[model samples]
Target: MYSGRVRPGGAPGVHELARLVVMKGVVGPLATNVYVLRDRFSGDELLIDAGAAPDRVLALAGDGPLRYLVTTHRHPDHWGALAAVAAAAPDAVTVAHEADAPAIPVPTALAVSGDGDRLTFGDVSVELIHLAGHTPGGLAVLYDDPTGPPHLWTGDSLFPGGVGKTHSAADFTSLLDDVEAKLFDRLPDETWVYPGHGDDTTLGAERPHLAAWRARGW
Candidate 1:
């Protein structure tokens, strides 16, 4: 039976790009998808959201020295294994948006602000787009690969069918507004969205339902 959740023993899959390679693995009781992005040329890597199973996450990283551990938000599901992963890579710098830095359990060595801020490792570069509402400092990592469509790691902000769950109408509005302006309006429809959980989707697939999502007021 398909429960729509990533269960334990779910194998990590790899997507290779011209300059980067992404390894996706599921962890945590919430089934958070932890992504390990590596620069093909330099072998530099970045781990996004160490949510659970430190051993599994570390194994997927292989022998490469992790340069950055980026926590998209302060949610427990996103950082469940953060401490263990950080301990494994003692030299890796922890990164988070300044707005949510104080809430992060681990020490954030780099507090990023503004959409223009970019993080680079070897030839791979990722642009950080701050999308609030899901969390005050929720960030979506954008990788503009020359070989393929742009890749966006949205965390819990934007998902396949709709936006992430929000507690209030105001919060939902804020998230929807940010997604439309910063993501859908600016990026191409072909852009690939790898969310915090579940399967991946494209912006094009979800573009038409924007109005429907708003009408329901979820």
Candidate 2:
């Protein structure tokens, strides 16, 4: 029963899936949403987007064994607290797309380049789907839960209303095409979307507006 009602200053919310658990909190000056996913049985954990506020990130990580820290994109606001979190948990492997690795100051121990790159922890498997536009190496994390709907964590590539911002029409087209084919085409409507900076939504909620989003040329 994830309420999907998190805000910058509000309390964090936790969602439980079949074999995994996710705790979400909005942190940093930009109010970026940080997600801490843990294995329900093994208690091993991985974090998505340190955002900022190291103390808050560590607190959300809790006492579980932090196995990995996956950054969705190359945005500064997205991984602001990555260095601190990685330092705190030296064992946690830093993961990011190879294309954007140069932009991120922190060293990425595991640079995933493929679309279906898998990061397995305990019994849970997370897939990294690359969506280029907002950034050449931007990526979206997909966790197709065994017992529930697929959960997608889109960094800045997508939101509740439309795809992430782009600098030009070409950039917008790149992002839109990738999002549509890779995400909308493959995943079901019930897939839950966890964006970088706002409330949660489902792909089904935003599917009908694909044409509108494209025509706007944003």
Candidate 3:
């Protein structure tokens, strides 16, 4: 048995010409936050980490053009909803890094993702970044424009206070370095960071904690 919460007002369903509504699925004991990125101007939506309640994903999507199902990692809690999501959005393509590609139940429609891979949803653009740490094939997705900092979907590889665990390799120094270089170092300081677990945070807030997390061997 698992527990989860539904966000109030449901972020934004459909913004105007320049509005982007983000529906967050606060689910399970983990409080996993699944996001539905919708560009009201174009009537298109992109889903990120459908780990929360399946119903929440459907409800948030409503009648929008559900296009992409992006996963940050292969963890069940993160990509577990792949099957359910496929059922709801049949035409959606499940995108993940090659390393985590096998985790998706329906790999036939799987698209190979990697650092610098660009994607689109209506008028929104998504970029993939390989931020392996919590798992051998962990991933992170970045959305960008000429506006502000890029929005990062940093799986368990990174959170507000720390990075994901290194249970497999028994060491996380490399993962820490990856985060420092590939994520924090490259992204703008004010980037909006939406993690697979816990509440949302920013690159600026997470940067200072990097040294501490690395020191702890996370």
Q: CA lDDT, every prediction?
A: 0.89, 0.92, 0.72
Where does candidate 1 have its weakest 10-residue lDDT segment? 1-10
Off by over 4 Å in 1: 1-7
Off by over 4 Å in 2: none
Candidate 3 or 2, higher lDDT? 2
Worst 10 residues of 2 by lDDT: 1-10
lDDT of 2 by residue, 1-218 (tens): 68877888777989888788989999988889999999989999989999899999999999968999999899999899999999999999999999998999999999988698988877788999999999988989999987889999999999999999999899999999999999999999999999998899999999999999999887
Please provide, for model 3 over 29-74, each residue's C-alpha lDDT reduced to its tens digit, 9 standing for 90 to 100. 5666777888878879888887756776677688878888887777
lDDT against true structure, model 2 = 0.92
Residue 71, candidate 2: how far off, in angstroms? 0.7
Clashing pairs in 1: none
Ranking by lDDT: 2, 1, 3
How far off is model 2, as Cα RMSD?
Answer: 0.9
